[model samples]
Target: MRVLGVDPGLTRCGVGVVEGTPGRPCTLVAVGVIRTDPDAPLPDRLLRLDTKLTEYIARFAPDAVAVERVFSQHNVASVIGTAQASGVAILAGARADVAVHTYTPSEVKAAITGSGTADKKQMTSMVTRLLRLEVAPKPADAADALALAICHVWRGGTQARIAAARTRVEEKGTRT
Candidate 1:
């Protein structure tokens, strides 16, 4: 399955695209960031975010968009900016008819590193090691994006398998 993972930020929104199921290697379709100058006005940044995100969704044509749920509560400004960026990414996914799901930081960490309280360094290291990536996904935000995709693929695969098995059981029972 095609998957697009997004790490939304005001100035640099990270995105990663991969195609595959869990335990299997997923081909990296594309991975990059949408950069907006922090000096620019908020509206301009949002516009830039919209344009870049739309382009990404169109280019990758992912089945789903996995994004990190906003967690930090210290800086209201930071939170607001991230929310806007995330909103634009979601809009792009909706436009492309892609299912969008938001996962908490803990969920992502647990999925990627088998720990809900994983530190940034641990998460980064785990992502690099698990993906067999030559270099760590850079700019922290980008790594987070890749992590999101990996998390979704892992969770989605499990869910799908369980669903298929349940369906099979139902069918067999109906026949009996």
Candidate 2:
């Protein structure tokens, strides 16, 4: 499956694309950040983000989108910006008719580094090793986005299959 992972931020939204199946290595398709001027109006920033995200969706044609779930932070303004960016990401996936999944920071860290408390350096190292990249993706945000994709490929695939099985069983019972 091809997956697009987003590390949503108002100023620098990171995006990564990978193709793989469960229990296998994933190949990196692309990695980059969408930058918006901090001075730009909020509405314009969001629109710019949406446009970039839409282009990515069309270019990559991902089977699913994985986004970092927004968590409470000391700065309410930062959290709000993140949440809004995340909403745009979710909307991009929905508009493209792809399944969207959100994973908390700890969930992604655990999946990538075997510890929920893994630091950015550890996460970056793990993501580099997992993807077999010669060099780490830059700007922590880019690495985080790749980590999110890897996590989804490893965990979300199984979850989706189980959900599908349950749906099939329900349909069978209804038919009966």
Find the candidate with the highest lDDT and give its number. 2
Give the top-scoring candidate (TM-score).
2
For model 1, residues 124-164, the per-residue Cα lDDT tens digits are: 89878867788888889888898899888989888889999
Tens-digit lDDT track of model 2 for 1-176: 89999999999999999999988889999999999999999999999999999999999999989999987862686989999999999999999999999999999999988999999999999899999999999988899999999999989988989999999999999999
User: Candidate 2 lDDT (Cα, whole model)?
Assistant: 0.94
What's each prediction's clash count?
Answer: 0, 0
Residue pairs with colliding backbones in model 2 are: none
**Cα lDDT for residue 15, model 2?**
98
What's the CA error at residue 81 for candidate 1, in Å?
A: 0.9
**Ten contiguous residues with the weakest lDDT in model 2:** 70-79
* Candidate 2 vs. true structure, TM-score: 0.92
Off by over 4 Å in 1: 72-74, 172-176
